[model samples]
Target: MSSPPEIGTAAAVQVQEVEHVYGTGADAVTALGPISLDVPRGSFLVIVGASGCGKSTLLRLIAGFEQPTSGAVRTAGERPLPGAGAGVVFQQPRLLPWKSVGGNVELALRYAGVPREERARRVPELLERVGLHNVAHRRIWQLSGGQQQRVAIARALAGDDPLLLLDEPFAALDALTRERLQEDLRLVSERTGRTSVFVTHSVEEAVFLGSRVVVLTKRPGRIALDLDIPLPRTGLEPDELRALPEYGALRAVLSHAVRDAAG
Candidate 1:
């Protein structure tokens, strides 16, 4: 793979020799072993591995929802601070049942200390960005599964943070809806120039969305392969990228890595 991006430069996030373990002593389990990686500013990085491979654990560490058992995790030149430099989207929408779609997003802004008056303006704009402005006043229950996930994404972006961490956000959707959202996510990431780290078990999704794809080994996850994706980044449809010969080659390589890790 091309040299990994330099850490703490313009890169939006950094993970250096990071490890995470659960339980203690005889019962200890290392969910993720030491691994180092740097994600270039405004680039999309996808981590793909089987279940129990520490994919979600890594995202959690970067989001500061969990502290590392050892080593360091940093974003923008400092150790990650909870709710500081990152925005996270999980597999489920996680919207408050009682809140309107706009209200859900507005809540995230409020927690980020956005002025009340500004939240009124920002909420609509964010919904529009995610193609859900028409449902801005709708209750969370009114939206389809896909639409709810879009709202979740809007809420995550409401913070306008530099780093975005997504853990299988589209895994539960039907294939068609998942593909559509993947395209939307690619466009949004490109438009906003935000650095993103997405974790998923889908090789196709990883190859399609990432500037670089990092595959990890099974339990006690380790970086098994870091592969650069060479699909053209400009004026190309997501489908077109998938059709490219390079895309298929990369997919095959990642497929093998996944099998090896699982075996």
Candidate 2:
């Protein structure tokens, strides 16, 4: 297999004092930011906080769905644009119900400008990358919730977008499935060396998935804590890694930060 790309040269995403507001004047409410963060290349960075902390708002800003009310956001040193810079996975699968599994991924590849012949070859590869074997022909409704989310992930990975932005992608799944997908995503990130930003409200999840974790305060959402996780990224199984003392320590710290910040 080929080596993973050299992804540590510079920041993959930069948020420079960004702030987002929902409305203007009396109706205006600052939803997020006036905070800055730099996500390094090939890193899995998780942003964790309370529900109203603007985690999703920050994510939208990075994806270029919404511009910041003030400050700036960049991906690969350029202003982020829709359908450029990042591949996004939301809490919902958001797949087209009419499309087959492979069809969904093919559409993403098509939008990504992949040739028709190349898309056929690439669809299965993307599905396999997310641990989906040969469910290509199945309808979206036929798949389980977990399976649907896996398709969403495969679709996101179909493109060569440098950054992967996940907004609580596993939040709706049951515990077992969520844990399994978490492990799969971790392996995928290690293999592909893509810079990823995951947003979640779970401290344990944050520590498990992030090379670095940032905890945000409530409301306008400032950074309360920024931590580097020194745990091994590969080799050990998820359970084994989670049982380590170091993992427990980081979780405890994050748990405390979340509680305090949410108040």
Taken over the whole model, the C-alpha lDDT of each candidate is: 0.89, 0.91
Tens digits of per-residue lDDT, candidate 2, 114-229, equal 99999999999999999999899999999999999999999999898889999999999999999999999999999899999999988989999999999999999999999999
Off by over 4 Å in 1: 1-10
How do all models score by TM-score?
0.94, 0.95
lDDT of 2: 0.91
Model 2 residue runs over 4 Å out of place are: 1-9
Return the top candidate by lDDT.
2
Tens digit of per-residue lDDT, candidate 1, span 1-263 = 12223346555777877889999989999999788888888889999999999999999988888888877777887778878888889999999999888889999999989999999999989988888757878998989999999999999999899999999999999999999999989989989999999999999999999999999999999999998887886888877888889889989999999999886
